[model samples]
Target: MNNKTKSILYGTLASSILLGVYFTVLTLVSGWSFTQ
Candidate 1:
């Protein structure tokens, strides 16, 4: 892949991981339960 495409892919992947981590931490702190 070219530099531009590679960077975009890496950036998207990083953001996704960060967002997932953020939500996980938020739910953990709030004692969130998905079934509820």
Candidate 2:
């Protein structure tokens, strides 16, 4: 894989993990409800 492709993959993975952590924290704080 090229440097560009590796960078893109890493960026995407980091963003997704951050998003997942944000959502999980939000859900826990909101008592497992999607509506916040």
Candidate 3:
């Protein structure tokens, strides 16, 4: 594999992971607010 391809793959993976964590935190916060 080339350097460019590897970097693209890594960037996509990191962004997806960050987005997942962001949404999870958002959902939990909303849920807690609803309970209170």
Per-residue lDDT tens digits of candidate 3, residues 1-36? 999999999999999999999878877888766544
> What TM-score goes with each of the models?
0.84, 0.81, 0.81
Please identify model 2 stretches exceeding 4 Å from their true place: 34-36
* Ranked by TM-score, top first: 1, 3, 2
lDDT of 3: 0.88
Off by over 4 Å in 3: 32-36
lDDT of 2 by residue, 1-36 (tens): 999999999999999999999888888888765744
Q: Report the C-alpha displacement of residue 3, candidate 3, in angstroms.
A: 0.5
Q: For model 1, which pairs clash?
A: none
Superposed Cα RMSD, model 2 = 1.7
What are the per-residue Cα lDDT tens digits for candidate 1 across 1-36? Answer: 899999999999999999999888888887778414
Number of the predicted model whose lDDT against the real structure is largest: 2
